[model samples]
Target chain A: MHEATLAANVLKIVSRAAAGKENRVARITVSVGELAGVMPAALIFAFNALKKETPLDRADLILIKEPVTACCDDCGTDYQPGPFPYHCPACGSRSFRITGGEEVRVKSMELKKEI
Target chain B: MCKTDHNHLEDIDLDCLVQEEDLRHSDRLKAAFRAAGVRGIGLLGSPGSGKTTLLEHLVPELMKKRRVAVIEGDLATDNDARRIQAAGAPAVELNTDGACHLDASMVETAFAELPEPKPELLLIENVGNLVCPVDFPVGEEIRLAVISAAEGEDKPLKYPAAVLRTEGVIITKTDLAPYVRVNPDKMVAYVRDMNPHSRVFLAHMDAAGKLVTEAADGGCSLEDWLLG
Candidate 1:
């Protein structure tokens, strides 16, 4: 649902990165965390719909999925949490803070060159 | 290698957060609220989560000492706005129409439509989908994730982003917990499992669907959490 916003922002970043350089984009790679609240299919749909005839048209989107990772403050161990009633597997500490799995970022963009 | 094999054009290293501009706009709004001595609180949850009911009780209580305003976000109809207005506060209805969530710019526009003198506390009751709303800040300095006890204990697990993004969690309809076979404490625990920094609040509703104002939880009550 929010992928359209994300897709628009991807175009913004792409526009900034490609200015005075290339217009045709070949691919855009984005990293999405499992807990980032982004649905991949929906994002692809939004991107495709927004990228028509623009620099991003025909540009492939590559998503790197990052799973939710939590770090135990007690033992300082990082572990992927299971569904519900989550706790640190190592120390069984519920005081652990989430260390990852909320990223929605553009890592790189490939632009097509005439030559 | 074939001449056309070099399909690579130019690789630009972005390594940037998506929607930085949008998030920055929200930050600016947050700063403006703080500077204006206004507190922007966003309430997000599922449909039928008692968000409007909480506001019906909360607005009057808040109006007793503070200037209160509300922006009701819904896909259609201004029913929530009407309810808030009846609760003794000025409210603006924001119909997203088809959008799943409200954003910073939308809040800014709606905030302007509110009747002045500007509110000391602004309650933005966001559209009722947990997944879409979690990603939009909407200029709220304090975001409370509202969950109905009848929705069961697995909601936090199912929507961890809502738990993680929100500053607090308000478990509403606690009086129905017994019938729903849902443990409110377990729901609170699940929130803690996802976010150690989130403040937790419990709210009980009376038989008439009104907030049980006197019922309080440990360390924090709904009033103290929202007011202060």
Candidate 2:
């Protein structure tokens, strides 16, 4: 459901950026967070459908998945549970500061132009 | 003595990619909303759950204190916009066409028609469906989900995504309390059990034209998060 929304956002940025350039897009790098609640497969599918007939029609979307991390304010501990949920390892408190995993950004774009 | 080609690689640095990876989406979204100077409040609920009606009643009171801009979303028609205009707030309609939800791009487009944010509150009337709107972020500071007594209390459990995402729940149509068998207390408890941190409010229009709180209503637990 949100995949379409994500695609629309990507398309908007890519289209605007491409408008300033004469050539087509080469690659678009996007950052996807683990807790962003977006499914990468669905986003890719939606992107493929929407990218056609637009400035980003031939652009390749490169998604980099970011890790989720949380910090405990009380105990001053940071936990990186790569394969598990986001609970604090030392205090076991579900209540902690979310330091990462909520980001969705396009880090950079590559363009092909006439030399 | 073997320093290797690390220095040579560093000198060339061809592997380093110099690209225009834009943080501009976040910047654009933030700038567009900042220019609108208006913070968004989302009214969410299922179709025919009296979300629009509740907005129609509540908006005049809110607008009396501050100028309000409304971004009304529907599958089609400018009906909600007309109604909100009638209610005295300048309203713009976003026709999602066949889409089920409103995304950030659509909202950004609406900003072009509205005035710069005048430190006023903007109300976004989401599409009359609960399932899709919850997944999309329209840059709202407060999201309020409406669940009418007529719609059954199990809705919170049934549609936990919307319920869990909101800062508050406004149970509409308290005037129909007598005809309906809804126990407000139980509904509040159920919502709290499901969301654990959402504020619940029972709304009814009073003679003074205010959405009066009734039945087991209190402050939201999520206020801490919202303020943070």
Highest lDDT model number: 1
Query: What is the per-residue lDDT of model 2 for residues B26-142, given as tens digits with 9 covering 90 to 100?
Result: 246656665666666777888887878776866776766667778888999999889988988788899988887776677777856775554367778888877767766676777
Off by over 4 Å in 1: A75-92, B1-8, B213-217
Model 1 lDDT tens row, A1-115 = 7899899888888877777864466889999998898999999899899988786677889999988888888899999988755778888887777788898989887777644
Local distance difference test, candidate 2: 0.68
Worst 10 residues of 2 chain A by lDDT: A79-88
Quote the chain B TM-score of every prediction.
0.92, 0.77
Cα lDDT tens digits, model 1, B1-228, are: 112236555677788989688789999999988998989999999999989999999889888878999999999999999999998899999999889899999999999888779999999999999888888888888899889999997898888889998888888888889999999888887887778778888888677767774322367567777888
Candidate 2 interface RMSD value: 9.1
Candidate 2 regions with alpha-carbon error over 4 angstroms: A1-115, B1-36, B115-119, B177-180, B205-211, B214-216, B220-228
